[model samples]
Target: MEYDYHCTVCRGHLRIGNKLVFSAKTRDNKYGLIFLSPELGDYTTEHHPDFDIQEGEEYLFYCPICHARLNHTENEKLVRIFMVDEKGAEYEIFFSGIAGEKCTYRMRDKEKEELGPDSEKYRQYFDLPDEYRKYL
Candidate 1:
């Protein structure tokens, strides 16, 4: 679903595609949802040391326009992230930490490694954006 919107922070025109789910554990041990590009595939699952997150908590999904963090809410059992662009248009997307049956091993391993602080790449993985970052 393409959205005609504007950035709430920068007031820039925002064109967003379909709602893609990116799941990770939050610092508070809660499941978090991040909206990102569907084309992103399993790229966010890659192990990086900079991104640190705990399962099942809230976190910011950076706005592409203003680079500010977007607000998250639980919508119909799915975690949804909401953002308004410069044009006052609102966009919402959903996600979950639990993987579907079709999920790939590469994506699962990447998420596991990122969530495991003992993993050598944990620190580096925490640095990535919430949509791409892994949680322990």
Candidate 2:
């Protein structure tokens, strides 16, 4: 099944087909959608000469179409991303990733009974696998 991500604020596409299919590098020197992976994981990023992050800097991931910030706020770890499952159900995913550390991810879902109308389905991450959970 294929899942997709869109910017809730601007309705912009962020991901498609296991890639960062959309891209944006603004005049303000900001880059778009960074999908950080494990040390040896196979992932793709645009190698633009003007796009470079110095040592000890947080990566910036903005929407390619609207340039809205995804992934995080300045100095904030938690990131809220908008996603759609294969069935076309929308969800708001919240997670955290620290700079220079291996990324972490979990898959789980639950009832939205208590949430208000504006809230879509919320899935709290299930316990990660032993290898991933051990380090947390």
Candidate 3:
């Protein structure tokens, strides 16, 4: 699917992708998983949402710092992104920034740990935007 997403800060073309699965731990130490596509935008559901990920569909998940393309198959376990509520009391893990930011928490003991590679814990540290942050 094609979209017209642009970065609000730089007006650069915001890359699009199919979010196959969003698995992370909640603030209460519970695991959660969500599956959806960007084409559906904000109307995602718990099962078989309006958006679908076709076989062999290419999705781009980029780095927040340099905006680089990430390789999902090889770097899935390395990177992660989390979203924290306004109260700072609730949070969730959304994306693992494996090939991009170099999370140290999740990928501890690895050669290059950005923030330890923990998805939920990383969200607690980074001040991510609400919309994009929720998908990770």
RMSD of each: 14.3, 10.5, 14.9
Model 3, residue 110: what's the lDDT?
24
Q: Which candidate wins on TM-score?
A: 2
| C-alpha lDDT of all candidate models, in order | 0.37, 0.46, 0.34
TM-score of 2: 0.50
Task: Name the 10 consecutive residues with the lowest summed lDDT in model 2.
Answer: 114-123
Question: To one decimal, what is the Cα RMSD in angstroms of model 2 from the true structure?
Answer: 10.5
**What is the C-alpha lDDT profile of model 3 across 47-134, one tens digit per residue?**
3333333322323444433454332333343223332233532222233322233233322122222333333455443445444544
Candidate 1 Cα lDDT to native: 0.37
Worst 10 residues of 3 by lDDT: 106-115
By the lDDT metric, which is better: model 2 or model 3?
A: 2
By TM-score, the candidates rank as: 2, 1, 3
Higher-scoring candidate on lDDT, 1 or 2: 2
Which parts of model 2 have CA positions greater than 4 angstroms off? 21-46, 54-56, 71-75, 95-99, 104-136
Pairs that clash in candidate 2: none
